[model samples]
Target: MLITEKKHGIRFAQRMSDLGTETAFVVLAKARQLESQGRTIVHLEIGEPDFETPAHIVDEAVRALKAGATHYGPSPGLPEARQAIARYVSETRRVPVDFERVVITPGAKPIMFYTILALVDEGDEVIYPNPGFPIYESVIRFVGGRPVPIQLHEENDFRLDVGELLDLVTDRTKLIIINSPQNPTGSILTAEDLEAVGRLALDRDIYILADEIYSRIIYEGDFTSILHVVPEAMDQVILLDGMSKTFAMTGWRLGWGVMQPTLAAAVAKLQTNSNSCTATFSQMVIPPALFGPQGPVEAMRAEFQRRRDAIVAGLNRIDRITCRKPAGAFYVFPNTSRLGVDSQTLADRMLQEAGVAALSGTAFGRFGEGYLRFSYANSIENIKLGLERVEAFVAKL
Candidate 1:
């Protein structure tokens, strides 16, 4: 029988207490609870893509399963799958992606863990964005690394201030995280900005952990990848990417980390010990997904662009809520602080009383205070309804 607190008085490790969680999942659970109580919630909380995984990718997975590809495989990933990822990254980042330097994991998440853990010793300082993805902060803390947050500016359209970022770096700083077409804010860093960070990392000999999951979900201007910006300094780079956002394959749980050969080998060993590779059948479908026609992918991006416009326009109509037009990704973070209300209160009231689901900006970071994130990943009808209810609720308050 499995040991449990009830049965054996199990004392969890002390480290477990230090771990943090993604509040999006917490908000999702609460939304579900209210939904079960017969509330009609127009969900704008989670960043999930409501679209189905493309038919071609689905067909490939089905074919792989039928062909008896359901067993455990190499932890670093199948050779053909790695080659396909290498091709995609090489084309997108303009860096010569070595297939051997790619280590496949269940999702982009594992790459974050592996890369951070591989580079960060206890007491090492890591610089990540404030008001950025919550998991980056959570994982750094969980691993005993000192997380130094660089506050992203709203006046700068949520772009990282190169001066501020460089000032925070010190001898203790080991890694700096770069997430373009970033989460929550949907801000894309400029190519020049990326090159500046690359120069800093090169001078300090610090690693750059680049999260480029939403590279293909871009709408305005171009997506400037870190590898493409400073290809010469790639030795200090670790690229994290996957199919979840781009291909609407969130549940497929497939992602890869591209790094120097030594780090890739170490990550593979870590994966072999822990995750034991992505599902065998999922790996079989990756090459087809990478090399196949991209009509469905382009269609999805166009639709997201349309939704992005609707949400930004709708939120702007509410005088108290000022949402910037995002360049990429599918979220709009509006400043609700103009109304003299905390983000948590506004988000909870919208869900519990107004039947609209949204996340408080504080759920991301303290720097995200005075803001609220609304995901446009849902349908246009629902996005309109969700924002309408929010507008009505804010009007009453």
Candidate 2:
């Protein structure tokens, strides 16, 4: 019966067996492994910005290091960083933020983990968007919460359907997750949608977690945060945002969650007990990144929009590929079922044979079965080359 028959074995917690993962990382690892063997992989799989963190933000971190700011810091982050974040959030989201309620983490991940662990108890229903971030479902299941998915679709322009979403909400739902400029599909939830969700959350006494990490990356119209519409959402209304997407600082591992005082305290305590705190030098860069000159941010956004246009147009030009121009974020989800291969097989064939890396729609959820998420977070040159390879690959199929 193998090694386990000996009973000298070690085993993981039952919950460990139930956990899911972000397939992006798995694809990234495969891409890296292929690259190590001298393969020229055109990466369109990962969501990280190809841009560097602004020099100003980098300078601040250097300054902090030179100033001997390295040490264990406050669990809720430095006062200065929190205050700067407060101003930044208040200005961008059009909502007043309490600095005391902000908890900075090593990355945006722990904020999700802590919030889910703190709020979701066994068997409670949690509503998250299908064809959305994999982590939301993973966290819910890890906590033993019943994950209820709201199916997103291309016909509705991938807009969050309030009626469809609320229909899934029962008295048992403890949390509802909303992500705009969303991952994989890059679909957005409108202000009206947010307002409806806010009303439902308030009426049902459900907590809301809005992941607005890509708020600054909008291509069309104005960007709306949950703050702009969900102020009255009953559950402390945790808002997660950070430097990773907006500032192209994913490697920095800096992000935060804004919440009400009570919940913030629990998160801070979680930070103290578990994470302790984020890096001091990283925390020190917030003011510069937030209150600095707006030129770099604007320039990067315009470039991303240009790339978005190129990729969407290019993908649509490929026979049997249908892509909707996303309103925000740096991804375009294309329906590839017309090619007569499942998304996972298509992704693998493209990566291994064509040297183009992308994520399968099934990586997100069952609703994403016929799609593939192509990230435009690369240069126009690379994006075009990758699509050319994809086009050639599809032609063969």
lDDT of 2 at 363: 92
| Off by more than 4 A, model 2 | 1-9
Measured against the true structure, the TM-scores of the candidates, in listed sequence, are 0.97, 0.96
lDDT of 2 by residue, 102-215 (tens): 889987888889999889999999899889999999989998999999999899888778889878988899999988988877778888888998888888888999898888
lDDT agreement with native, every candidate: 0.90, 0.89
lDDT of 1 by residue, 1-397 (tens): 5545356565899778767878888888999998898888888888878999999899999999999998989889999999999998898888898899898899899999899888898899999988999888888888899999998889999999999997899999999998989998999999889999999999999999999999999997678898888998898999999989989988999999999999999999999889778898998888888889899889999999999999899999986889899999888889998888898998888888899888899888899999999889899999888878888888988
